[model samples]
Target: MNAATMRAVQVVRAGAPFAVTQLPVPEPGPGAVRIKVHACGVCGGENLARLGLLGVQLPRVPGHEIAGTVDAAGPGVTVWKPGDRVGVGWHGGSCFVCDSCRTGDFVNCADRRIVGLHYDGGYAEYVVAPQDALARIPAALSFEEAGPLMCAGITTFNALRNCGARPGDTVAVQGVGGLGHLAVQFADRMGFRTVAVNRGRDKEAIARQLGADEYIDSTEDKSPGEVLGRLGGAAAVISTVGSSPAQADIVQGLSPNGRLVVIATDHEPIPLGPELLVFGRRVVAGWYSGHAKDSEEAMAFAALKGVRPMVETRPLEDAEAAFQNLGAARFRTVLTL
Candidate 1:
């Protein structure tokens, strides 16, 4: 196939605002595959990338939630073929020889590159993905419906699945935006007593529709501890947001021995009372997206459980506007190529 330049959203300088323009479509390099993007989901991390937080490699593309067909494959790329449908998430690639990779845990690979930052990402029509990080897009789902899962879906899915969330356990999803919404659905299918914890009762109906068995509006009841007291405490509380205020709100809400898992946010200087950790308890942290295989398993499970993201799709050229809108909107946005 003849290669041609394509339109892309590029942040050409660090600490400066982003802009959109055309750039030549990239060719697959060694151990890589060039994906003809179908849809690219805007992520919160991408905003961080935009602000030069991920080491500020400009001109940056700043998108990782990718889904598309493989248009070309590079030497040593054995896993994919031209025209095959695939998806890429936050994890772009990993050093295969690293200890983590040797243990089949690519997510922990020390030299891993994030999709939009470490490597050129999916905000354009073509994105170069590492052979080891690509996951097959399930036939049951469409490009738009499947976009956010590449990141939001797999990350939240891996969190609970990896933590051994079992049936009938009480799982509380704190914040019902991008990640929290899907977490509720996953918890529900796992047979957990799902609880959605958010700021207002406004999201109650929405949370319930996503399979939350109960809702706790933190604004009305600032004490998540008292609110969760009604459900007898949660087996685990997944704080989807990392802002200091949000972290401070839910860290103490976990049950005795129950864990608090934080993902994709800056939940640092985690202010916790010393008394909260007196027992044989813990607060764990992890990335939401998993290995390529883990992503595939997450997709299959979502398919089986009827868990899907509620997304809005816009044309690829509108990526910049879409991203800005994403920062303000209630639901996640997917850019259709």
Candidate 2:
């Protein structure tokens, strides 16, 4: 490989095969930092680039769950320095003068910059990002482990913490796959009575071992809502699956004032009756991945509490195959550079 160029996998065209190409190393601009990416997680959210669903430009390096080290700090950048371990997620940067940023709600910024969507991302040997988009990686966490935590980890962790469920309250994580697995762990560690809900009993034992107080198979005669209702109803249900009907089926399981947090990206409208929400004050809300500080906190919590993601690793060269098989991965797939 040429010293001036880096090998990266890019979506040369929307809805086309990923192309491995050599590109010149990028320099961080003012207020930005260049990262030597050690690992990048292949996430379902990459569809935004793969399918061009978010107006992502062609020939884009697509990845947001990035874990790396600062290799260069651009002009005017001070908080980050070379050799610092860091991670970057979906929330790349925000216009500080925007109303959302002024109020400290950068995630909701009107002109939020998404890492992979708005600019070149971490599917390469190096990536340049705004300083505010970087999160410190805990010493106890490896690059591969920290990569997924930037996206999946922070999403579930932040969602569960903000779902308004108190300690000892019933909190259920729907689906035991990629995001669901992490949600179960976070819910368990957060002091809630964690319940793992899935389609079959295949993952029941794993769920229990992951700290779920109970497991519910949706295929059983009783619906998940029925089972959760029998168990006193869930104070919050974190729906990690992308099926709207499945999410809708779990609403009746929420206790009075219970919240259903949707983290998965599903465009299908969730059908619901007015009585279902009006009578119980139930809420269905969507949660976007959090900011860099939130990612830092999630990593620190995981490092301190032994919360880890079950991941499959592949070399950066195999990103094409890895991304193609992401749906079948154990939980998360990390691309090692």
Candidate 3:
């Protein structure tokens, strides 16, 4: 198979709709591999792209949570062989000579490329990526089931796990949306007492059903912060809500030494009263998607705990529509080739 030609979804302009066009498949460069994409998950990042919020260069594919198989390999790409199942996430490729890469902190690399944003992504029949960003998917995992973890999964997993979550800690996930729902499950399975904090009576049932031991309805009775305070305050607040308004309401709920892990949106400044941080000793931190350390661990944990996203699949041609659906607060959407 020459595999010289393949199809992909291209974003030609920001703020306008995306189009599915057939483009020549990119050959893997040195330390890279070409993958035949079986599935790619739509993400909040695409939502940002569609709205021009991310401000990425126009006309780019917009998917990072990718799952597929290696069809070809570039020179020096020895970790993967042809036909091997694999995945690529948001941290598409990094400059190895950078200080961050030298320190094994590829996520903070000065010259990092993001799939779909910085380069063409997996929203197609085939995509190519640096071997360092690739993780071998488990044999038992299906492409659809494993796709979301590449971005969404690894993001939440890294945020919490790296933040020092321990068994039996009170982990409150404010906003039971896409990331919140997954965080609840991850925390529950990881032995934390999970709390789902949302602003309505609507999410209570579903939140608990998704393994949240506690639900705080911010819309009624008390604000989520007050509710969290009543529960003795959270040991850690993993905020999946992107908006500052949402985060502003819950920031005060963190206990002394507790952390607020915010990852939903960029440029949304989270405001905290200086006294609160000084008195309560709470910390507010933001996390990007993932590095190899966390992504690799996330896959192993997903396989170990059966933590797959509650995904809705759309055809590759419908990627733009899928982006709309995802933006409308629709849960998980995976684009299948």
Candidate 4:
């Protein structure tokens, strides 16, 4: 195609197939930067645009785990310039005057913009994003490695770091999938006694290789909570799966005053009892993907600690197939342009 036009995969309607169309290369508005997208990870979060959840408009490019270099910067944008490597995650931008932003919680801003949902995202050759939404990718990370780190990496890393579990605490990572796999590594590097809980023994070897100190098979007659209780209970459980029953079942595994941090998204309500929380002062909290600074920190930590996500790369043209098999991917799937 010409320089002015670029290939983009867009969801034309709710639950419709992704349409590969030629669109004019978007120019950066004031305080924005246009990126030459090198890689974008296909995440379940794309369902927001694919299914039109959260009232997303039609004909929207769906991708938030973006990694690339700045091609151009708009007027009034000084922090980022052309050729600087950067990545953008779910938190696109926030209204600076909002109460949440004023309190330094941009992720919870009254008017928080989400990448891919608010505008065209990195499911294309070019994506324009707000200046403040850019996260500097460390030199050690490739575009493919940095893409998933923007969302999956940040969500797991940020949540584990802020989950109030101290070093040496028993931290169990539920589901050794996309987020769980990374969470296992982060938990180990963070000095926690990491536990990997999954369906069977099939992933035990890999989990241990990823630094999990222990493995619990959920399919066994003994529940995950019971297994953890035998090991002195877990200081925290990071639930990376969207199964509500599984989340509730793991609650009994928490030590007194233990916390359960849920990062996976599901509409079903967790059937938790008052007794469970009242007896041990346990807490069930949810963590959203972090802001730009958080993403940078997560990437830096991953680079320093030699933590990386196992990803399968596909050509940009295969975005539909990649997204369709997202859940079945070994861990993460990235679309390379």
lDDT of each: 0.81, 0.93, 0.81, 0.94
Per-candidate RMSD vs. true structure?
1.8, 1.2, 1.9, 1.1
Q: For candidate 2, write residues 1-337 as lDDT tens digits.
A: 2479999999888889888999999988899999999999999888889998777878899999999999999999989989999999999998998888999999999999998888999999999999999999999999999999999999999999999999999999999998999999999998999999999899999899888999999999466888898999999999999999888889989999999999985789998777879998999998989999999999999999889999999998898899889878988999999
Model 3 spans > 4 angstroms off: 47-58
Error of 2 at 180 (Å): 0.7
Model number with the top lDDT: 4
What ordering of candidates by lDDT runs from best to worst? Answer: 4, 2, 3, 1
* Candidate 1 wrongly placed segments (more than 4 Å): 280-284
lDDT per residue, candidate 3, 76-103, as tens digits?
9878898898899988878989998899
If scored against the real structure, what TM-score would every candidate get? 0.94, 0.98, 0.94, 0.98
Per-residue C-alpha lDDT of model 1 across residues 87-106, encoded as one tens digit per residue:
88888888989998899877
By lDDT, is 1 or 4 better? 4
Superior by TM-score: candidate 1 or candidate 4: 4
Task: Kindly indicate the candidate among 1 and 2 with the higher lDDT.
Answer: 2
Candidate 4 regions exceeding 4 Å error are: none
lDDT of 1 at 79: 78
lDDT of 1: 0.81
Query: Where does candidate 2 stray beyond 4 Å?
Result: none
